[model samples]
Target: MNQGKTKKIVYKTVLHIVLIILSVTMLVPFLWMISSSLKTTQEMFASPPTWIPRYVAWENYTYMLQAAPWMRYFGNTFFISALTIAGQLITCSMAAYAFARLRFKGRNLIFLIYLGTMMIPFQVVMIPQFKIVKILGLVNTHWSLIVPGIFNAFGTFLLRQFFQTIPKELEEAAKIDGCGYPRIFWEIVIKNSKPAIITLVVFTFMNTWNDFQRPLIFLNDDSLWTLSMGLAKFQGTYVTQWNQMMAGALITMVPVLVLYIFAQKYFVQGIVMSGLKE
Candidate 1:
């Protein structure tokens, strides 16, 4: 091979080696979580540490299930996540559509102010938000969780950016066919925005499903606790059950993992498309 070709080969090989090392580093925690879940408490703390349990403790899963109302937590989380996803998709998309397609006064200013809300940390608004929820009589109810999450500044910004990329010709044509704003939105915008919609769905679902703080503040009822809250039961003041916690954590990860797996293709596309502008 020529010197240039040899140099390219060496560079590519070194790049691959570095990537492999980084990939393995990122995977270590996940792999260890799986391994720890299958181990007994004693085995988990064994000298030199064991990557694979000598004896797989299937009882860890059973113990985890018996320790808490995991099935109910799962149901509550799924229900909350579903409603949040639906609400965000509808509300954010409409807001985005208006900002993207419709001409109105102060549109850019309004959008900028709305987007500025994203910079405010949730901690700053936690107390006021709870008070508002209480005033609306939604405190200690699922609505408290679902309502606040439904309208997100980030989601609006994401969808708006994506909506701006759609060809104006499509909307104009739809109007020529006697389609009103609603019909055009449904047929022209939403129908063609699957990638962005699914991307938002995955984002909203993951956020709602993994949320711990909001539920912690709003939901005082044990029956309404999410998996993140339920996992706290594995932790004791004096001694934490490492194995059971790992098992419960693994269980909690299943839904998020399944969601990302199915939406993996559209998720990437949506993110990329949302960043593009006409």
Candidate 2:
């Protein structure tokens, strides 16, 4: 008994040490980003990378705002992310529910086709997508970004898997009570699938928020540029302004970080729940 207790203690101690090391490794880059953002130009390029800046130059942030259309970028990013998430949630949830519970013709074959698209690289289709967007007169508009993301194959697949795990007895009970499909879906399935929905929201927000390629390809006007695109331009124009660049980068990450912190619990729970057998 004593030997077994000692072995368990040693195992826990080793596990704790490994976790601590991994945590520090993950945090180092972010800590460096924040530290460099607050440093002066000279301090940023000092012989050894400074773990902490000698002086915290708050002016770096103010200067970044003055140097670019930061406010416009922020607004554009928020608008795109909000619209994309709204469309994705509605469309993906409905599709997922139908695929999971409802019987329809060629259902498996249609789902297989949808899954097949996921294997196709985005690069292979970008030129074609651009041509289609231009033909629709949405090339320079936010609709270009919003429209493509609305019918996401991955979101549908994820939610379908989660919905399949839900007990059919609940749906049967709702049916007996004279509840329609929409009513049952909204009140029963969606309520129980909060974790999965939150997971989708977090993913959609992060992807749309940080995306640069789509904005660069679709938006030609500077005023319509998202934060990621604006930041890329800022980096190129102010190559020497490491401080300001870091500040802008940090500002860009704020919304995503805040969202992750809030939704992290549901994100983890959803992942675990999705993997378990019903």
Candidate 3:
């Protein structure tokens, strides 16, 4: 028994060591980015790249801020991301409810077709989506980004799986108490599905926030450009501002990081529970 206990202890210790190593490995790039953001161009490219900058270039951030209309870029990004999250929550939840609960003809077939859309890469649909948006005269507008991102197949699938795991007895009781489908959905299913909802919100926010290609294709005006677009153009025709670029990149990551930190518990729970139903 003592030998068996020792073996289990060794196994657990080894597992923890492996996980710590993997965590540090993944953090290396992020750590480097932070280091680079604080360094001058020369120090950033020094022969032996220093993790600690000899001379911290605080001006890099200030320069990056002055270099672009970051306020407008942030406003545009937030506007688009907020609307996309709202629209996805409403549309995806409704669709997922119908798919998970309602008995309708061709539901499974329709769901399968909808799920198949996830397999299609964004690159494949870019041209056609661009043409459609152009025809709608939404080119050079934020709506071009918001409208395309409003409904997501993965969000619907995730919510539907979570909704299915909800006990039907609570819904039945609500029905017997004269509660309608809308009431039951709002009070029962939605209230219990917080983790899944938060998970979808995080995913939608991250995708919309980081999305570069869609905005690039649809928006022609500089004022409509997002952080991604703004950062891409930070490079000069003759010179690349590596330090300033790294600073901007670091700042760009803050929103997503804060969001994940807050929603991490729910996100992990949602991912685990959603898979259990399938």
Residue 46 CA displacement from its true place in model 1, Å: 1.2
Clashing pairs in 1: none
What is the full ranking by TM-score, best candidate first? Answer: 1, 2, 3
Give each model's whole-structure lDDT: 0.88, 0.88, 0.87
lDDT of 1 by residue, 164-212 (tens): 8999999998888999999999999999988788888888887889898
Ranking by lDDT: 2, 1, 3
TM-score-best of 2 and 3: 2
Question: 1-278, model 3: which lDDT tens digit per residue?
Answer: 99999999999999999999999999998998899999988897798789999998999999888878888898889999999999999999999999998888999999999988988999999999999988998878999988888989888999998899999999999999999889988999999998789888887888889988888788988898898887776664316777888888987888888877888886676567556534
Model 3, 273: alpha-carbon shift in Å?
6.7
Task: State which candidate, 2 or 3, has the greater lDDT.
Answer: 2
Off by over 4 Å in 1: 236-238, 269-278
**C-alpha lDDT of residue 241 in model 2:** 76
lDDT of 3 at 79: 92
